[model samples]
Target: MFGYSEEQIAAFGLSFGVGAFILYMLFIIGQLAWESKAGKFGTFVMFLGLAFGMVGYLAKYIIRWYLER
Candidate 1:
């Protein structure tokens, strides 16, 4: 069990925000000029990683609530 207070929850949000921003800026934005096999594959993987990160972050609390109860 993760024993986190309100401040910790806010920190999670902050960290997630920063990470998501970095992912979008570095990977997502790079796709704008991608036209090769490696670039395309890299872009695809980056998108999946980004999606998973967002989904996991948003679902953490909901999943924890369900499992805890």
Candidate 2:
């Protein structure tokens, strides 16, 4: 479709699409902390707790790149 192969489209979606979603998730986490009036330490803790999974997911990509080198 649109002159692009399925693998190309899928790669684009996995890279840019999921990247955008991850950014949006960060925004949501920040909004949550803001609405709850979480102070600096509280906000830090909230991010550390909530965004941990995202960190791991990103790390997986890094690890794969490193191993493939």
Candidate 3:
């Protein structure tokens, strides 16, 4: 579709699309903290708790790149 192969489209979606979604999720977390009037430490804890999974996901990509090199 649109002159791009399936593999190319899938790669683009996996990379940019998921990345954008992750950022959006972070925004949502921040908004949650703001709306709830979480203090600085509370906000930090919230992010540490909520965004921890994202850290592992990003780390997997980094580890893969390192292993490939």
lDDT leader: 3
- Predictions: Cα RMSD each: 7.2, 1.1, 1.0
- Clashes per candidate, residues 3 or more apart or on different chains: 0, 0, 0
Cα lDDT tens digits for candidate 2, 26-59: 9999999999999999999999999898887788
Summed over model 2, clashes come to: 0
- State how far residue 57 of model 2 sits from its true place (Å): 1.5
- TM-score for each model: 0.37, 0.87, 0.90
Ranking by lDDT: 3, 2, 1
**lDDT at position 42, candidate 1:** 75
Model 2 residue runs over 4 Å out of place are: none
Error of 3 at 4 (Å): 1.7
Question: Between 1 and 2, whose lDDT is larger?
Answer: 2
Predictions in order: lDDT: 0.67, 0.93, 0.96
Off by over 4 Å in 1: 35-69
Q: State candidate 3's TM-score.
A: 0.90
Q: Give the Å shift of residue 18 in candidate 3.
A: 0.5
On residues 1-69, what C-alpha lDDT tens digit does candidate 1 reach at each position? 288898988888777876778577656545653744447677777666646666675587678789999
lDDT for residue 29 in candidate 3, whole number 0-100: 99
